[model samples]
Target: MLRAHTVEDVRRAEAAAMADLPDGALMQRAAAGLAAAVVDLLDGAYGRRVVLLVGPGDNGGDALWAGARLAGRGARVEALLLADRVHAGGLAALRAAGGLATRDPDDLSAAPDLLVDGIVGIGGRPGLRPEAAAALARFPAVPVVAVDVPSGVDVDTGRLDGPHVRADLTVTFGTHKVAHLVDPAATASGALHLVDLGLDPDELGPPALEALQPDDVRALLPRPGPDAQKYTRGVVGVRAGSGTYPGAALLAVSGAGCGLVGMVRYLGPEHIADTVRTAHPEVVGAGRVQAWVVGPGGGDDAGSMLAEARADGVPVVVDADALRHVDAPMPGCVLTPHAGELAAMTGVERAEIEADPLHHAREAARRWDCVVLLKGHHTLVADPAGRVRVTTTGVPWLATAGAGDVLAGLVGALLAAGLEPYDAASVGSWVHGAAATEASAGGPLTAGGVAVQIPRLVRATLNPSGSRPLE
Candidate 1:
């Protein structure tokens, strides 16, 4: 799992580590790591031109010291001091290493190979200073390597309120900040490289957010035991689609039949059910099921489907048209809502939800008393208890229609297989996103293509020996 800590947590850990270490030790370690990362980007330090955007605090100090190291290695380094009061010791070291320092932006005449953004670390607010903005505007094409975080992002909330440096590479120390994992800000943070400062894991407290890796998903995925039978594995029921949208029924059943569930039962309008049967011959009429997936293109009957699914007293995955009918939390229910659907549930604007997804998703989870899966570029699964798992896999091609229908059925199958609401939602989302990437293969894909790819993706994860790259 990729854990993202808040700024306060990082500050507390840094303070504790600094209290025991000698003077300047932490900064030196950070500087060394930052310099090494920049060296790797440049490939060879000698004769390369590097520019440092230095600010007032320790962030700027890190850049200055790193600039000093680059200068020592025969790189031409220039420091553009953006603040009136800079780190005096760091400036002296840079000067000692033959790095030029200037307060004027015009001193930077030619484009450098790389720009180091050390202005406004995790401590600063969302927007950039006028000087910083001007300096950034001067070099439109220069690739930036941000120290700790890209300057001016909301380090705690992952919100981007104003202009911030968009980094090509971010070399963060200690641990990942919330901005590194959460979107909007995460999109600005190009590629992340963590440099360990040896902070104790206990000191960092709990993570603000987490992204499940492949191994984490593998551990959570349902696997049959030696004595397991078809019935024991689990059965998932689908109550989705209507005669008006029979394709939704077929897509949902396709996802449920991905082998996550031993059986898939479909209950819907007669015409849609017939269509589902023809497309997925393995699907049967409604019967006993361990869990239910309700409401994708369910039309006017969505309310009845939700109520019936809730009456079963098993976990349910509520999605699409059923979202508005959800007045209170259902026991063991997972609510999947896109920005617009979430807006309708919470009475907030869709734009606002998209702007700050983490806050809105958590609020909805608490309000509805269930696991809320807010779909987006980075899908978020928030439990009522406040824990969150972000889905970091997927391509832009996944924005096509019918994707959510497939995801709802897949999650319901996992829930039937006995994974908790949180795990089922998180793992289902991870696999859904990964399957989209596999089906796309750098091109376009339909909802059916994505659904068909899920079993292959699951099989590869379940048996690594038979795995090959998806094309």
Candidate 2:
């Protein structure tokens, strides 16, 4: 899994490394890596015009040192020192390498092929300074390579507070930051490249969220043995849809019907149940279930079934309409709530939850004592213990109606197949997102199409060469 730690975790990791090594060794290593990437971008560094927007701290030092390396390779480099004070050693090294440092902002009209933004790093707050903002406005056409992080982005929170630099490429030091995984800021970071600083992963504190790599999800997937039967694997009971909306039930069942799941049970209106049975004859009515997916379109009727499932000690995935029925904490339950449902659960306005989803999702997880999966641009899955995983692979086209029902059912399938609530939710989200990508293919996709695409996507994730790409 690709893990993204918070800025505090990164700072601690950096501090630990700095204490073990020489004073300037970390900075040198970071600069060397940055320089190499910049050179690669230049193809050959003979007479390439490189511009560095320098700031006051170690971030500026990194830029200056990288500029020196480029100068040594015969690249004509210029540094625009925005701050009054700069890194003494790095600045002197750049000067010795035949690089010129100036304080004027107007001279930035010499738009180079690439701009290295050293204006702010992970430690700085979001939004640009007066001088830095003005200078960047001059070169709208130049492709930017952000050092450490794109300036004016919340490094720790991944939320964009204001105007931020949209980088074509960002070379970050040590580990991936929260901004690299979370939305808004993650979207601003065009293409990310990490420079290994040899920081110990175990030494770092808990990460904000983790992205499930193919191998990670593959390892978590359930495999049936030779003697495995339909009843032996696990039974998932899905209580969703009503007379008004039968398609929600159909879509959820489609997501859950992947061969990974042994059996699907229906408990709702007869017509909707008939629709599910018509589409997939394998499903049966509610029997003893290993896990339950309660919600989708069954508005008020969801409460009783959700309560029954919660009382049975079976792991339940509470979603959509059933979100209101989440009365008390269930130890092994998973709650999937979009912003509006999350607001209802947390007793806050939908706007407030939308503003800062990470904070509110964690709050709900803790309060409900269950795994909370908040659906949005960057789908966040948080456990009651505060561990979180963020899924970053969906597009705007996946926002169609009944999309969430498909996701909830997918998670239910995972839960029935014997994954923990957290792992099941995370893995299910990964599959849901991947399926959406395959279904969309850059154009609009219906919710049904997304659900239909899950089985192939799941197979591809499990065995890379075993499945066909969605056409």
Candidate 3:
């Protein structure tokens, strides 16, 4: 699992670590890691041009010290001080190591091969200062390596209010920050690298967010035991689509039948049922099921389908048109909603929900008393108690239609497989996104294609022979 802590938690952990160590120990560790990461980015330390955007706080100190290290290894490093008062000790060290420090950006003869952004730390508010913004604008094309975090992003909320440094790579110390895992800000953070600061995990408290890796998903997946039978493996029921949109039923059933559930039960209009059975002949008529997936192109009968599914007294994965009918959270229910659907449920504007997805998703989960899976670039699966798992495996090509329907069915299958609502949602989301990536393969993909790739992804995850485990 890739766990992300809040700014306050990181601060507390840092303070705890610093109390027992030397005054400059933590900074030295961070600087060493930062410099090493920069060297890797540059492919070598010798004869390379590097620019440091230095600020007033410890973040700037980290950059200055890292620049000193680079200068020691023969890199042409320069620090463009953006603050009125910078870290004096770090500046002195840089100067001693043959790195030039100047308040003027124009003192640099040319654009450096890479830019190091240490202008603002996690505690800094969103949006860039004038000087920092100007320096970034000057070298717009240069790739950036952010220390701790990309400056000007909300470290706690992962929201980008205005101009923020978009880093090609972010080297975070101690642990991952909320901005590194959540969306909008996460989109700005290209790739993430963690450098251990040796902080005590006990002081960090619980993580603000968690992301499931392949191994985590593998461990959570419901695999058949030696004595397992078909009934013991679980069955999932699908109540989706109608004559108007029979494709939704086919797609939803396709996802449910991707080897997660032992059997798929179809419960819809005869025409849609026929279509589902034709596409997925293994699907049987409506019968007893461990879980039911409702909504998703149910058209005029979505509310009825949801009502019937709830009456079954089994876990349900609610999606699409059925979301509007949800007043109170049902027992063992997972509500899947995109921004617009979430807006409708919460009575917030879609733009507002999109702007602060974490807040809204949590609010909806708490208000409805269910696991709310808010689908987007980074899918959020939030439990009623505010625990969240972010899915970060999909590509941009997954924005195709009927994708959510497929996800709904996939999650329902996991629910039937005996996973709790939170685990089921998180695991299903990870698989859904991974399957989308597998199907896309750096190109366009349809909803059906994503569904079809689920079994393949599951096979690979269950039997990862030589592949590296997801971190």
Candidate 4:
């Protein structure tokens, strides 16, 4: 699992760790790791030209010390002091190590091979200073390496309000910030590299955000027992599709009956149901089910279907048109909505919801007292209790039509398989994304193509070495 800590949590943990160590030891550790990463990027620092945008804080100190290390290794390192008061000790060390430092903007005439952004750390607010932005404009095409979190990004919320450093790589110490995992800021953070400072895990408390990795998803997967039967395993019901969109029903059933659930129960118009039965002969007419997925392309009849599904008293995966009917608290249901649907449901602008998805998702989950699965580039599943899990396994090709319907059905299948609302939504999203990636192979794919890849992906995930299972 990839865990992301808040800025306050990071600060608290840093203080606790610093108390146990020497004064300059912590900065030295960060500097050594930063320098080593720069060297690897340069493929040997000899005769390389490196420039550091020095600020007034510890971020600048880290850059200065790392610059000193590069200077010692035959790199022509120069520090551009952007602040009136820089780290005195770090500046002195840089000068002793043969690195040149100048407060004059004219000294920045020669653009270096790489730029180090240490203008603002996690403590600073969102925008960059005029001089800092000007310095960056001087070298428009240079690859940048940010010290910790990208300068000028909201370290806690992952929102970008103004000018922020767009880095090719960000070397974070201790642990990841919310900005590194969440979007907007995450997009600015080109690639992430962690430098282990070995802080106490106990002091960090619980993470604000958690991302499920392959191993974590594998552990959470539901495997059938030896005596598992059709009824014993699980049954997922789909109340999606209409005369207008029969493909929605087929796609939803395809996802639910992808060998993850034992049986599928499809309840829709007789015509659409016939189509579903024809495509998936194993699916049966609705009778009893462990879970129900409602409203994919359901038009005006969505409310009635949702009401019937809710009457069954089973966990429900609400999507598309059904979101508008969600006026009351469902308690244990999963509400799947894209930005536009979510905006309509909450009466907030779609732009606002997309800008700070973490906050909006959490608020919606809390208000509805259920799981809010907000689908996007990085899918987020937030529970009423405020815990969130980010799904980061899909490619851009997964944005095609009917992909969300497939995801909704998969979530219902997981729910029927007895995973809690939170786990069901998050795990289903992870699997759906992985399946899309496998199906696409860096090319275009339809929603049905994605559903067909689930079983193979699951088998591969469970048996990464492709060895025979103990059947």
lDDT (CA) per prediction: 0.91, 0.86, 0.92, 0.92
**Candidate 3 lDDT for residue 199:** 90
Stretches of candidate 2 off by over 4 Å are: 42-44, 465-471
Would you list the clashing residue pairs of candidate 2?
127-152
Write down the TM-score of every candidate. 0.97, 0.93, 0.98, 0.97
- Model 1 lDDT tens row, 1-471: 899899889999999999999999999999999999999999989999999999999999999999999999999999999999999989999999999999988887588999999998999999898889999999999999999999989998889988999999999999998888787888989899999998978999999999999889888889877788878999999999986777787888888889987899999988888888888888999789999999998989999999998998998999998887999766579999999999998889988998899999999999888899999988999998899989999989999999999999999999999899999999999999999999999999999999999999998887778855454
Q: List the residue pairs that clash in candidate 1.
A: none
Better of 2 and 3 by TM-score: 3
Q: Candidate 4 residues 153-191, lDDT tens each?
A: 988888998888999999999998899978778888878
RMSD of each: 2.2, 2.8, 2.4, 1.3
Q: Give the lDDT of residue 263 in candidate 2.
A: 93
Number of clashes recorded per candidate: 0, 1, 0, 0
Write the candidate numbers in order of decreasing TM-score.
Answer: 3, 4, 1, 2
Candidate 2 residue lDDT tens string, 1-471: 788887788888888999999999999999999999988877977788888999998999999999999999998888999899999998999999998889986665476877899998888998998889888887889989999999999887777777788998899998888888776677788888899998977768667778887788889988777889998888898888977777878878877777777899988888788888999999999688889988888777888868877777899988888888878887798999989988887789998787677788888899989999999888999999888899977888999999999998889988998999999999999888988999999999998898889887877787687755454
Give the lDDT of residue 248 in candidate 3.
88
**Candidate 3 weakest lDDT stretch, 10 residues:** 462-471
Of candidates 3 and 1, the better by lDDT = 3
Number of colliding residue pairs in model 4? 0
Model 1, stretches more than 4 Å misplaced?
Answer: 465-471
